[model samples]
Target: MKKNLLSIIILALLVVNIGMTAFMMLSVMTTNSQTAKLISDIAAALELEANGGNTGGFSGSASGNVGVSNIATFGFTGDDQLTINLKPGSDGKAHYMLVEVVFSMNTASADYATLGTSESLAGMRELIKGKVTNTLSSYTIEELQADDGPAKEKILEEVQELYNSNFIYDVTFSSVLYQ
Candidate 1:
């Protein structure tokens, strides 16, 4: 009777192990399939670019100047530059950061007409400065100093969220200096 009970327990354990193994295998297979699809999509996009195709709409590519090492500086945006001054969220040491922000846009943007005029541009600049200052003040010195950090993305998102009429395509930090 004891031998029969032991045999049953061993069989149950083996069954549970087999079930878990099957579940893991299925999950892996699903992940691999999705990865394959993503690779194909990326390949197709690259092929089109190589063939000199006008890939309409945002290409979802990084738009910034490649600076020394990995640091990027993007001050190439024609006449639309917004400079901001703020102190990063400091722990002890006092550090101030100067940020030159630029937005990439086309003629179709809603803010395009207003940006051309000095009066309207001034108004927009005020809005930008206010939003950017608020955004920048939230980041820590370490975050701002990183090569690729979440602070930049957060700043862009916050600024864009506040000014929807600006019709911003991409936000670039033209220049960043910390002192």
Candidate 2:
């Protein structure tokens, strides 16, 4: 009788251990699934922004100190009037895009002398064009086709990071076309 009781007790313990293991496994799986869902949402937002659906949805809120109207007056702008070809996305078709960008400057910032001066940027036109060309070539067609913007706003964002802080206070897209 004692042996039978011991047997029953051991079986119960085994069952409990198995149940606990299963429960832990399910808990871990649920957390992983939730994390994956969050990642998917963020990826969708990035894709939309790349296609221009949500321009400012991601990062860097605008500096209220710089207003939109000031772009033409104080901004240094660049235009890729010529069409650019981008890498094909999953669609596997040739993509063409044209973009015009307005880059703003802060008068109070130290970068003004170098990047704020329209004449200085004008002299660097070829360099700017090279940067744009390289940037555009890196994006996929679907990214440019979403409507009014290109992937990453690479032109404005990259230039600022590559040059100096506040050298680019704001970036405005004048025109964007994808086909």
Candidate 3:
């Protein structure tokens, strides 16, 4: 009968469609799992957290939990903010940044007693400014703008080394403008 044959043909096509859909889903799921694993591996290798809180700038010798009560800040603002001429990028245009650098000192550290006060650190301000200038002027605008984490880490390291102490535990660019 023509009706019976047509029904059988339609049923066969539907069955094939269902089978193909299941196969495609299985293939896609396997690839998705593989991609997720690769991303996880890369994040772990870079010591990055999923929440993206830690930028690794305060790692190494200066890393520790300093309570808010034990923290002191010395900042460069207004006329004190640094104006750095950056290294030229591929575009070959001179770029500059106006940045305010702030140092977070650990008030509880022994070094703080000798060097952490505003008056004490002011004497070394020129030297610290030079270090910041040297670190920043070496990077091209593109490089510096891509991610500032490395630059901040380098400056923090140099400052700590300059004093031979970790009393200054963090450096922050509280304000910045690039042009």
Candidate 4:
């Protein structure tokens, strides 16, 4: 009789363990599905691809396709490099960034014919420098030091906005000095 009783107790515990496992699995699966749905919703809202492809950090304008032949580069170096006064950080000290930038423009754009030339670019030097200065000055020294991507992107966007076109598709900092 004791042997039978022991066997019954073992069977009961095994059944209970299986039931608890099923319950936990169902709970986890439900939560996981909900989280996945949330991520999909957010991605769709942002117009992001689910495959997670990178555009090589170059965001093309218009048709979202840029060819090598369509690219034109304008650079600021030497005396033309921007020396910007950055915003004060937590330490309340002044900071500066000396940055040499290069702009990759879409030569296929209509504005490119008007503004993409070296002489035309030189004529608009102050506007370009002002955009760079305003954008860089908004960031604290520490923030700018952490990652240069955001600053470059902001400058590109501002330049695009200034001209009411995305003729300038990319901005690169060939050299940077922070002090």
Higher-lDDT candidate of 3 and 4: 3
The lDDT, on a scale of 0 to 1, for candidate 3 is: 0.84
- Cα lDDT listed for each candidate: 0.58, 0.63, 0.84, 0.81
Candidate 1: minimum summed lDDT over ten consecutive residues — where? 57-66
Global Cα lDDT for candidate 1: 0.58
**Per-residue alpha-carbon lDDT of candidate 4 for residues 71-166, written as tens digits (9 for 90 to 100):** 888878878888889999989999999989888888887778987888888888889888888999999999988887898878887887777766
On residues 127-171, what C-alpha lDDT tens digit does candidate 1 reach at each position? Answer: 666766777776666767765246555555555555543334356
Candidate 2, position 18, lDDT: 100
Error of 2 at 24 (Å): 35
* Alpha-carbon runs more than 4 Å astray in model 4: 47-72, 88-93, 107-119, 146-150
TM-scores for all candidates? 0.48, 0.52, 0.67, 0.69
Instruction: Write out the backbone clash pairs for model 1.
Output: none
> lDDT rank, highest first?
3, 4, 2, 1
lDDT of 4 at 82: 82
Prediction 2 TM-score vs. true: 0.52
- State residue 121's C-alpha deviation in candidate 2, in Å: 0.7
Per-residue lDDT over 1-179 for candidate 3, one digit per residue giving the tens place of the 0 to 100 score: 99999999999999999999999999999999999999998987655432223443334433456899999898787789999999998999999999999988989888899999778798999999999999999988898789998898889889988988778878889898999
Candidate 1, superposed: residue stretches over 4 Å from native = 1-35, 38-91, 114-118, 147-149
